[model samples]
Each structure stands twice: as C-alpha cells, then as structure tokens.
Target: MRRAPIIAVVLALAVPSLARADIQPHKAIYDLVDEDGAATGGRVEYEILGNACDGWAVLQKIDIPKAGARVVTTNASWEAADGSAMRFHETTERDGQTVSRFRGQAASGSNGFAVFTDGEGGESFGQLPQGTLLPTLQTKTLLTQAKRDRSVLSSNKVFLGTSSEGALPLEITSVLSPRASTPGDHPELDGQPSWNVTSSFYEAGGRPDTGPDYTVRSIQFGNGVVQSMEITREGATARARLRSLDLYEVVECNR
Candidate 1:
C-alpha cells in the first residue's frame, strides 16, 4: 500500500504558468480510521522538503496497532530536481522485528527508465515504460490535468515503487470536481478552495475496470495541500483526516 498515503500520492504543484516559489514544503499529521471502526490506534505522518531546482525529500510513517499483527512502515524517497531520477528506501517492522527493507534507484534511460535494487531480501532489476513518471512529477501531472475543464483524466502511467518491485508501472484514472471548504485552525488553508480528486490504480497493459488494484480519493486545496485522504482496496476503506499542518518558509536554492 502507499504507506505515505499522502506522500505516495500528493507532491509538488508547479504548472507551466506558475512560478517555482509556488512549491510548498511542509509537515502534516493525519489520524486514521478503518471502516466499521474495527481498528483503532492508527496514525500517519508526512513531511516534504526541497524544490524543483534542488531535488525533493519526502518521508512518511504509518503505525497501526493491531492486537497481534501490529506493524509500522516508513517510506523515504528523494527525487532529482528535474524529476529525471530518484532514490527510494522503505523499511517495514512488525512486532518489534525488522521484517523487510528495500533500497533502490531509478533513472531515465535510452529506452525508458531502469531500476536497480539491492535490499535485505534480494537483488532485482526492473524496467519502467517510456511514459512512466516518478512520484512528484506524477502528482504534478495530476494537478495540472485536474485543473482543466475536463472532469476525468485517464491512462496516466506512474511508477510508485514501494519495494524492490516498485518500478512496475501502474495506470491511473482520475475524476475531479470543485469543492467548498470550511474555516480551520491553519489560516493558510482555512476557507481555501478545494477539489475532490478520486483516482484509481490499475495494472499496466490490461483493462482498468476488470478491478483496480486500489483507489485513492482526497480533498486537495488550491495550494496543493491534501486536507484529507481515503484509500480503498478489496472492498475495505481506511480514512485519514488532516489534524495538523505546518508550512515551511520557502528556501532559495543556491544552485
């Protein structure tokens, strides 16, 4: 799953007509609840740093306390300034034991893109389709298209690699619409215009409706802040609410 839920999903929002300063660097916290309230004691934290001229840093941590299958997942990744390459590492711990870890990098290639991994369990190689996009660029594309007059955007390919197999391309289909907002603690976001973005993920090279691997629906604001998110898979859904938000001062790049 996109443990970063928000991280694996939302990134930068630099449209052609916008200035780079429009990029946002912030830290956010979300509390999670599964359908039926069957699971409690769950939380997700996300933070983003850097800019398009100096690469981007993202970190997400998810903790779920189940009776016996308690698990915590941490996802960290760095995308190159131009979105041409990226390095990612993920660690999953269960019941106090480090269960899995993956470290890898993907770069643009003559054909498309290539991925090499040497993690705790094994070593592997993977290839991304020619149109495949790294996470941040993928999100930028989502926001760009969402702002258009169209209501639905489909067939966008993105590589959201979470493990050694992270390079596999997933087709994305999104439905978007304008939304209203309410007053909130953070004035930067309070009463801001928002959009309802619902995206479905499907395996590449197949029919999307056969059954999407998963779907993500989020409340995205004009400034690119994802106020809340929900991820659904196998007919079950987990929801996360934005409980905290901190926008960082934009740092000028010396490069």
Candidate 2:
C-alpha cells in the first residue's frame, strides 16, 4: 500500500543550529500497535544527532511483523546541512532479505534542485521545480512557517528522494497547546508547548479536498520531538507511542 514514502515522515528542523537553538538532540524509541490495542509486532527507533555547523543526521528504523514468519523492516538515514546539499538512503527488507533500496543526493542548482540517484541501476534522476525542498528542509520550513504565522495550517512540496517522482505536495494542520494540559507517560515534556499535527501527503498540484494519498498524525514538541504518531491508509491504522527519550547536550554556536 505504498509504504516506502511513509518512512520519511519524521519531523526535522531547517538546519542544525536552528534546531539546536530550539530543539534538543535526542534519541527516541516507540512501540507500535493497532486500533484494537493489539500488538502489531512493530517497533520504531529514531535518533537525531549533530549540530547546524556539522550538519544534522537523522536515523530511523522500523520493523513490522506479519502473520507468517515474514517481517518487514525499513531503515532510512538522512543528512543535510544548511539546505544546500542532502544525502539520503533507504532500504527495505522482507524476512531479512533486501527487497528495495534507494540511495540518492540532492543539491541546489542554478534553476532549481538537482537530484541524482543510483537506484534500480542508476536510472532515477531528475530536476525538481525551483521551490521544491528536500524532506529535512521541508520539515524545518514547515515548523518555521507555522511559528511565524502562528497558524495551524501550512503547505509545501517535498522531494521524497526515494523515487524519480518529482515531489509530493503536503498540507499540514497543527493544534498547539500546553504540554502540561494533557496527561501522558513522558512527564519530562510537561510545561513545554506541544502540537498535535496532521499531515496529508498527496500528488503535486492535487486538490486538497480530493483526499490524501496518506495521512500521519503526530504529537510533537515545540522543539521538534515527536512524542507519538499514527499513520492511516486505506482504513488500516498503525500507531507509535514514545517509550524512552534521551536528550543530548547541545553545542553552543559562537555568534
């Protein structure tokens, strides 16, 4: 059900420094389940590292087990610094055997962003429209725009990097409230601003009312940490809740 792109739906800021100034470097673990509260035999582990000067590195791994002796695992790593250049790699495996893999890079060009991929025999490469953004940059932009406008709705086009398909249009709606107002397992996040965000990913230029190809709902911290998330497609829903969090020391950038 078009699950590859769903792995890139994590939240990140524009650059490391911007994120460091607001968000903290951290490692998070989440447990996955279904609507019936039954264990889906899925787990997710995410780590964000580095700073704006050295660039930001994001690593994510997800494992979902099926009824039989088969299990699907998706691993993705993304690195970007200053929005000028980006490198991404995603690999999906079934029952411990590689099923699909994508390795690519994108950079700013004179006209727009140029994407180069070595996937499927090095045939997937193209130029994105001028305003197109890589996933990490897009996330950063979304957070910046949301705070600037102080509104709940924002839209942008993001290059998935996994495929030759140009870009995916995204509409994000957020609800901001005090973290202390709600009750949850992570008391360390209390008193900070929290956001309940819903993001719809669709084909570029697709009408917003036409329904989204995929939708993800996440409860995220003001500093960009996602405490929990749920993804839905074709009436099937999967949920991920934070299990543990480790905040790293922030590097002080000399002004």
Candidate 3:
C-alpha cells in the first residue's frame, strides 16, 4: 500500500488539422485489472511523441509483480514544446535496483509559473497561481474545456513536476458526456465523436468532503483518443483498455 498519489493517472491526450490540434502523438497499450477483476500482475504502457508544431513527448511504463521473483518498475518522462514550458523525469525500479528519482523544470512566469526541482528531495522553488496548468497543458486544457462547456468544465490547478518532493498540487475536474458512439472493438474508433469523461483529482485546496484523490473514467476520442479507462482510488478500482493504438506521423510546420 501507500503509493497512491494516484500515479497522476498517467495524463491524457488528440484531434488534428488546426495545426494538428494541440497534440496527437500516439502509442498506447493498457491492460491492468483490479477491484475484483483480478490480474493485478500489472501492465501499462504509454507514449505520445512530438507534434503541435513541435514540442511534446511523454513516455510512461509501469510493471508490477513484487514478492518472490520481484519486478517493480515505474518510469515516466515529459518534454514540452510550449505547454507553458516543461521538462520532467521520474524513475522507480526494484528488481533492477534504483529506487526513486525525479527531476523537474517549469517555466512561463510573469506572475504564475516558475518551478525548479531536483531529485530525491534536494533543491526546490515553487510558485504557481496565475492560470496554473502544466502536464501537457493540463491535457490541452481538458479538451478545450470539454468542447466549449457542453457541461461541467472549469476547474483546473495542476502542476505535477513529476515530484521532486515538491511541486504537488492537483485539482482537476472535467465532466462532459452525452455524445457517444464508438466502441465496437475500436476499429480505429469508428466515427469519432466521443465524450464520456469524468476526471477528478484533488488535493490543491481539497474540499467537497475530501472525496477525490483520484478518479478517471474515460471515453474521450473526438480526436484525442482515450478509448476506455476507469481508475479510482481508496475504493480501489483499476481498468484501462485499448490494447493497442498507434498514430504518429504528422510533421508539417513551416510558418
């Protein structure tokens, strides 16, 4: 137990055209189960590399199986082009050694963003208030505020410098559902047009009866693929489907 910062829920992403729509780099694979479904042996792979005119890269990996044979890995990465400027790193290993590590950088400070950190708890500096949003620009500002306020959107205050024992403050809540179609074993997500999201991660000023510490229910699509997800904490729940997906080939920026 005790390892629940909710894993940052592994971030989210995609739409294109309009200059490749903020972001759309892909490579995903998920299959983890718990909450009675079993199979907690572990699995999660993530990738979102480059685009949005140049600047985006994220890699994630998590494997679990600890006890006899031992195997626990958790890796993370992020490199930003402009999402308010960012650079982060993370690590955790077990059978292969290396226990913990973290590195950080955040910019865009006129009065709102400026954070710098160094691993295993060493250096630190923080201050994020004005419009604070980092972590792939807060998932592209929660899919453009859940597509222009279709319903419930407008609650953000994020900054996860991948933990240097510092930069911690997450409070995001975006909900918008009622336009769906696409889930027939994927089939390249059929026609698109999806939304049945439900994100909730709190701790920044946490209230609302101290409920959310982690929550994510997904469907996303509409370009930013999410396919399916269900992550809860405390009550214990874990699910992530969308076995495989790949789409990354868009580089046309000459302006």
Candidate 4:
C-alpha cells in the first residue's frame, strides 16, 4: 500500500496557478486506472477541510472487480498538507459505542499524532503511541517494519534501505505535476475543486534490477483529498485501482 499516503497527498492540491483564496469544503470520487490505461475497479474518498485539517478514506476491494469482499481502512490522514497548524480527533464504533480515538496537532513546521484503540471488551489508550514533528519531504522516515518494502515522506526522493530483498529496486515513481481544473455543473461532487494529476515513479530507486518505467494517475486537492488513484508495475499481471462512491459530513473535533 505504498501508494496509499501519496493518494491522500493528491487530494490536497492548492494549485500554484489558481488565484483563488479560500478553499471550499468538498468530497470527491476518483476513477482508478492501470498502466495500460484501463479501469482497475478501485476507488477513494476525499473530504475537503473547512479548517487546517483534511480527511481521507481509502477502500480497495476484492472478489468482484469493482467491490471488495474484505475491506479495512488501508490508511487515513487528518492533517493539513499545506503546512499549517491543525488538530484532529477520530472515533470509531463497532456495535454502537466508541471503540477508538486518535488525536493530534500540527503547528506550522511541526506536528504530533496519537492513537487509542478499544477492542470488543472496552476502550483504552494504555498502549497508544505519540510522535512530534510534521512529516515532510525533508523528514524522510520509514513507515513500515518490513524489510521487503520502502515508503517515505518526501515527494521527490526515494530512500531504499541498504538491505532490500526484492528482485527490483523501488525508486521514486511519481512527482505530482500541475493540476487542471474541473469544469461544468458537476463541481467535483466533493465541494473542493478537482484536478488531473500524474506521478512518475522510477524502478531504479528500489528496483534497480527491474526493467521498464511505472507511473500513477490521480485526482486530488491541496488540502489532502484524493478522489481516485491507481498503481501498476510496468508489466505486472495485476494492477489495483480505487474509487469513491459517496461522501457525508462527520463530526468536527475542534469543539
């Protein structure tokens, strides 16, 4: 799921070319595509923020080409991608009551995050973790403990560890280019503006031994709302795509 976070970043686009000031809150649905430019039956949801923080929901399905028989939140981020001060609190319920809570703050160049999870028995933050410092292009960090994969925070750089056990090197695949606006009465259904974006990821950064080039196609906003995205290897047998079907308002934690 290395493409997960990058999908969120796609939704957060403050087009440097646009003259608009205030960004509208919106929700968008994206159509995922493969390397061959075919639909992959995947989707994403982007919740544009009214404040400094934005929200994302990702779903990759199975069994059916367009739907998932097994689905878990692959990843979620409630941070403002524009590098502003922000805070977020998230709660989940299984049968009725709250089962988890996540709260954090991001101020200018620095940010903090924490998570509290509750099982079927009860809720607790006993093992919750915390971190300080907002993730950035300069703050390249390893997100997973696995030795076979590499994921980083920067946009233009790919840092594969010294010991990787893969046939191909996973280099920086895509760098987001300028956005093209959405036209007509559609208004992107997500309230926020829409755009067409592309990223070019390399095989040399992590898969130096592999042949061919791979890229990702995405639609997003500056506040971190990814409408849709897809990932495909140059010549892989299967590629995955994600799309979002609906969007609704959630509770605001600032109160």
Q: Highest TM-score among the candidates is held by which one?
A: 1
> Could you tell me every candidate's TM-score relative to the true structure?
0.83, 0.82, 0.32, 0.39
Candidates by TM-score, descending order: 1, 2, 4, 3
Pick out the ten consecutive residues of candidate 3 with the lowest summed lDDT. Answer: 11-20
Alpha-carbon shift of residue 123 in model 4 (angstroms): 21
Q: 1 or 3, which is superior by lDDT?
A: 1
Please report, in order, the local distance difference test score of every candidate based on alpha carbons. Answer: 0.65, 0.61, 0.61, 0.34
lDDT of 2 by residue, 28-85 (tens): 8777876765666777777887766666777777777666755554445455556666
Off by over 4 Å in 1: 1-19, 35-39, 67-69, 116-118, 148-152, 184-186, 204-206, 253-255
Evaluated at residue 169, the lDDT of candidate 4 is: 19
Give residue 137's lDDT in candidate 3 (0 to 100).
67
lDDT of 1 by residue, 1-255 (tens): 223333344332211111344556788877786665443678777787886677778788888776778778887888876667888787778887887777777865446565545453566666776777766676666555666653546567776656422557677777778776666535678755567888877765657658777778877765556777777877877787777889898777766
Give the residue spans of candidate 3 off by over 4 A.
Answer: 1-29, 32-42, 45-61, 64-91, 94-96, 103-121, 124-130, 134-144, 147-159, 163-180, 185-225, 228-255
How do the residues 87-177 of candidate 3 rate in per-residue lDDT, one tens digit apiece?
7666667788876665667664455554544344666666777777666666666556556665556577767665422555577776776
Residue 35 in model 3: shift from native, Å?
A: 29
In order, how many clashes per candidate? Answer: 1, 2, 2, 42
After superposition, the stretches of candidate 2 with alpha carbons farther than 4 Å from their true spots are: 5-7, 11-20, 70-74, 108-110, 114-120, 163-180, 205-209
Clashing pairs in 1: 161-166
Spell out the clash pairs found in candidate 3.
14-223, 14-224
